[model samples]
Target: MQVASNFKVLFIAGFGPIVREPSESRELYCEVLGIPFKEESGGYLHTEALQGAKTFALWPLSQAAHSCFDSDSWPEDIPVPQAWLEFDGDSVEKATANLESRGYRILVRNKQEPWGQTVTRFLSPEGILVGVTFTPSMRKEK
Candidate 1:
């Protein structure tokens, strides 16, 4: 049975591994796979060339930590996520509420990033860092 909710995911905004080793990740995604990733500050490597996802990147663990907790280290109480996935939705607030009502503990709630994306984050059963987001730039691409 499918339970309906106010939250609606429009598309997958992004997906990538939360890399502990930047060099190894880069070597595999860029060198071995020839992903043509562009390096950014904080050792972030990303590319929009991949067809299935709007963005694909090797997101450094420290960067993910900083994004979620405003610190360079992940909280010890939380399980370290191996990768991250984002779902672009109609309303982040609604999605957040839905998740909370379903008993999911949210990590971050409707936080806007410096790069102009509003997101609510949490961890999935498989340990993937998931984000319900409203990304204006990505929506504009549609």
Candidate 2:
């Protein structure tokens, strides 16, 4: 088989949040963390944080809830992708604890991966899966 020569991750595109409670997610994400994000309930919220990169979008609360839990009624708007955005950090455990201490739900706790990465995951206000990870030094050899 011929090898494909192109290898790049320009966007490395990760899914953004589509919250159940736009206000709360926005408040926690923007107000609490001081991360700049816009609010758009009708269609979805788009952010300017990652320019020239992929953008994040939000959906209405009702629509998102229905989409995830299997509601009979589906929104006319396009469905948000079912994926998680992986954010690499120096301290995954520290970050996970901080979010948990603040009362945010934690879907997964800090767990060590065989590949040498510590990871944690959770649902955003909109029900989208979000994650934080750290590459453990042991995996540096690979």
Candidate 1, run of 10 with poorest lDDT: 25-34
lDDT of 1 by residue, 26-45 (tens): 65446433468888899888
Cα lDDT of model 2 by residue, 54-78, tens digit: 3344545454334334464434563
Q: Could you tell me the lDDT of residue 19 within candidate 1?
A: 64
Residue 139 CA displacement from its true place in model 1, Å:
1.5
